[model samples]
Target: MDLQQMRYVVAVAETASFTRAAEACHVVQSALSHQVARLEKELGARLFERTSRRVRLTTAGEAFLPAARQALEAAERARAEVAAATGEIRGRLTVGSIPTVAAVDLPSVIRTYRRRYPQVRFSLRAGSSERLVEQVRDGALDAAFLGVQPGFLPQGVRDREIGQGRHVAVMAPDHPLAARHEVDLRLMAGEVFVDFADGSAARAQSDQAFAALGLRREVAFEVSGVELMLRMVRQALGIALLPGAFGAELHGLRCVPITDGPVRVERLVWSRFPPTPAAAAFLALLDV
Candidate 1:
C-alpha cells in the first residue's frame, strides 16, 4: 500500500526468494514477508505465488510492477526537487564511458565535477562505445562519453563533440620500426595489424585511410577496447593503431606517426538523455 511495502514486493519478485530479497533491501526476512502480505491484503489479490521450490509473480504482480517502479522514481524526483529548491543539488547521476576515455580523461573531470558539486553523486560505468550508446538510449545512464561512432545515437539522445586528439601506431620497443620517429604506411605492407573490430568508428576511418593509399595489411587481431589492443601490442602480439591517449602510458611501446595517410582524430563525445541541470553544468565544463 505504501512505498516501503511496494519496494519490498518488487525486491522479493526480482530475487524470487524472501531471504535474498530481505538481504538486498537491508531488512530482516520476516519484516519483508509481513509487508508483502499486508500489501496483498490491501490489493485483495495475490501478487506472488510462492511454492516451496520457487516464487513467481502472479498476473496482478506483473501488472503492478512497472507502476510501482515509476512511483518510486517519481517519489525520488520529488525529493530531489525539494532538495534543489533549497539550493542543494543532490541526486545520483549515472554515466558511461569507453575504457580509453575512462583511463585518460575521466579522472580529472570526475574530480573536478565532484569538487564543484559535492552534493551530486556519480555512478560511472565503463564499456565499449556501442554498448554505452544503448545504455544512454534505454535511460540506464544519465549520460555517457562514447567514441563518435557513426549512426550510434538514437533519437532523443543528444551527442556533443568536445575535443579531438591524434591517433598513433603502437608497437613493441623491440620491433624494427621502433627506432623510427615515423613510418610510412607503405612500409607496413604485409605486416600483422591489431585494430578495432569491423564497423567500429575507428576501424571504418582506418579502413578508408588504407583504401585511399591502396595499402593492405593482414589483420592479426581485432578488439573492442583500445587499451586492451595496446597491451597486446606491447606483448609483441602485433602492432596496434589507436588514439594517442592509449599509448601515453606505455613505457615499453613506441608510438609513431603513420605517414603516407590521413592522420586519425580521436573524438571526445558525450551522449545524454533528457538533460539534467547538473549534467548541463558538467557539459559546460567540457566545453570550456
Candidate 2:
C-alpha cells in the first residue's frame, strides 16, 4: 500500500529471503518482515510462501511483482527528473556488456562518467551478447555493449555500430604457424583449437568461418573467457581464433591474421523506450 512496504516486497521477491532482503535494504529482519506482513494483510493475499529452507512467490505475488517494480521505477524516475531540472543528475545507471569488450575502454569511460555525475550510481553486468541484448530489451539493463557477427543487429532496441574487427589465429610462440605473417584458414584447419563455448557469439565467429570453407577444426578446449582461452593457447594445448586486438598485449602468444576470418561488429544498444535521466547522461557521454 506504501512505497516503503512495496520496496520491502520487491527486495524480498528479488532476494527470496527476508534475512537477505533486509540486509540488502539496510534494515533489520523483523521490521522488514513486519512491513511485508502488514502489506500482505492489507491486500488480503499471501504474497510469499515461507519455509525454513526457501521463500517462493505465490501466484498473487507473481501477479503483484511487475506492477510493484514499475511503481518503484516510476518513483525513482520522477525524483531523477526533478534533479535533472536543477542541472543535476541522480539515479542508478545499469549497464551490460560482453566480457570481451574492446571497442571502448570501459574503465576509463566509467571513471569519466563518475567524475561528471558523482550523484549517480552504477551497476555493470557481464554476459553473452545475446543475453545482454535481451536484458536491454526487457528493461533489466539501461544499456549494453554487444559484439556480434557482422550484418546482424539486435532487434527491439536502438543500436549503433561502434567498431569493427576481424578474428585472428592465436598460438604459442613455437606454434607451427606462428612464424607466418598471415595464415589461411585452410592451412590452420589441422590444428587443435581452444575457443569460447559452442554456440556462443564468440565461438560462432570461428565456427562460421570454417563452415564457409568446408573445413572443420577440432575444438579440444572450450572456455567462457578470453583469458582462459589465451592461457590454454599459451600452454600449447590448442590455438584460438579471437579478435585481433585481444592478442596485442598478451605475452608469449603470437597472433596471426586469418586470411578469411569472421568479422566482429561492436555495437551499443539501449532500450527503445525513453531513457531515464541518468541513462541519458551516460549516452550523451558516449555520443550515442
Candidate 3:
C-alpha cells in the first residue's frame, strides 16, 4: 500500500478510535475510516474490530502494524538520504590528476576544500594524462587535472584552461650554462639531453622545439617522472630541458632561461563537470 495509506493505518491502530486517529492525522473520521477499509480489503485481512463502545486490533492488525510503521520509516529515510546527496552536496568525490599537477598544485587546493567542507571525503589518484582521461571518461573519477595530448581528447569530457607553464634548461650549479643569464638554442645544439619518456605532453613539446632548431643531441638518459629526471640531472649525468617550475625548485640545479624561438605553455586543464560546492570553494580559495 502507499505511504499515505500506511500512515493512516498506523495512526488508527495507535489511537484505537477512528475519531481520535482522524484528529491526530488532520483528517475527518469518515475519510480515515474509508482509507483504512480500503487497505483491509486490499490485504484480504481485517486490521481492526470495532465494537459499539470501543475499537480494538484483530490478530492480523497487530502483526501488520509494526511492518507498516517500518516501511514508512524506511521510505522517509531514503528520501532524506537522496536529498542530502543531491540537494545538500556532501559525499565522496574521487579526483584524478597527472603526476606533475598533483605534486605541484592540488595539495593546497585539497587542503582548502577539506577545511571548508569537512563532511565530504576525497580520493586522489595520480597517473599519466592518458590514464586520467580514461578514468574520467569511464566515470571512475568525478574530475581530474591532466595534461592534454596533441590529439583529440575523449568524447563527453570538457576541458578548462587553468594556466600555462613552460620548459626551461636544468643543469648542475657548476655547469657553464649557469654563468649566463639566459641560454639560446645555438648553445644547446650539441649538449646531452635528459629527456622525458614517451607519451608525455612535455616530451612532445620538447621534441618539437628541438626539431625546429634542427638539433639532434645525445640522450644521456630517459626517465618517466620529473623528480627522477632532476635526480639524474643532479648527478651531472646530463643536463635536461624540463618544465620551468620543476627546474626552478631544485637545490643544486641551475635553471636558466630558454631564449629560444617560442616557449611551450603548460596548460592546467580541468573537467567540464560543474564543480561541487567543495570544488567550487576550493577554486575560490585559490583566487588569492
**Highest-scoring model, lDDT:** 2
Q: Which ten residues in a row have the lowest lDDT in candidate 1?
A: 261-270
- Model 2 over residues 103-158: C-alpha lDDT tens digits? 99998999999999999999999998989989999999999999888877799999
- Pairwise lDDT winner, candidates 1 and 3: 1
RMSD per candidate (Å) reads: 3.4, 1.4, 17.0
Alpha-carbon error at 83 in model 3, in Å? 5.6
lDDT of 3 by residue, 169-200 (tens): 88888887878888876788778888777656
Backbone clash total for model 3 is 1
Name every residue pair that clashes in candidate 2: none
How much is the lDDT of residue 237 in candidate 1? 88
lDDT of 2 at 90: 95
Could you give the candidate ranking by lDDT, starting with the highest?
Answer: 2, 1, 3
Give the higher-TM-score candidate: 1 or 2. Answer: 2
lDDT to native, each model:
0.73, 0.90, 0.70
Worst lDDT run of 10 residues, candidate 2, spans 242-251
- The TM-score of candidate 2 is 0.95
Candidate of highest TM-score: 2
- List ranges where model 3 is wrong by over 4 Å: 1-88, 102-104, 148-156, 267-288
